[model samples]
Target: MSADTLITLDTPTDGTTVSGSFDAKGTANSPEANVPWRILDAGGQKVLHGHFTAEGWMDKLYPYAGTVDVSKLAPGSYTFEVSVDDPSGGEGKAPQKVDRSITVQ
Candidate 1:
């Protein structure tokens, strides 16, 4: 699958600075409309993770929006990533993922 067609993040764009809670909004086309996400510290250590369902799926890309809280995390740079859920467990092609850097204050 083409990387560009897999997913797109619209809010909290790259190099953004956020505090407390922030919105994560984007569009994605993946199995069962499942959009899994994670936050990693600069050292590449996972800090937060979870999954959220899209508004719709199957025929085309659907919108997904959710809130991520960083109030408990220490102030620093981190990576926010969203990946397509591949239930095939590698039997199919590799999953697609998109990530961006952000600074938490």
Candidate 2:
């Protein structure tokens, strides 16, 4: 039950100038068969959300990579919450989360 998944968002600028992507790496983790992720602003607003399939179980591993767009968002701090969904397994054992604050200004 060791799924070490990593989600990263990169914004090199401020306001509408900032834009980047989200990435995941499941190889080193417990190999998540299926998982969902969501991006939120500082005010707990939903910005973006997505899910992944465990198609490449053997070769790909768990930590997969994804992308997002944050340029249109206003200048302020934000947060991200990634939820795990493994129908084959139970709850709490599959989900993983990571949080960070960023300023668009």
Q: What is the alpha-carbon lDDT of model 1 when measured against the actual structure?
A: 0.89
What residue pairs clash in candidate 1, if any at all?
Answer: none
Q: What lDDT does each candidate get?
A: 0.89, 0.49
Question: What would you estimate as the lDDT of candidate 2?
Answer: 0.49
Best by lDDT, which number? 1
Residues 9-99, candidate 1, lDDT per residue (tens digit)? 8987999999998899998987899999999999999999988789877778899989998899999999999988889988988788889
Query: Highest TM-score among the candidates is held by which one?
Result: 1
* Candidate 2's TM-score: 0.51
lDDT of 1 at 99: 91
The residue-by-residue lDDT of candidate 2 on 1-105, one tens digit each, is: 334443322322223223354344332222455446666877688887776554445343444455555667676666654544545557545445544454444
lDDT of 2 at 53: 51
Count of backbone clashes, every candidate in sequence: 0, 12
Residue 100, model 2: lDDT of 47
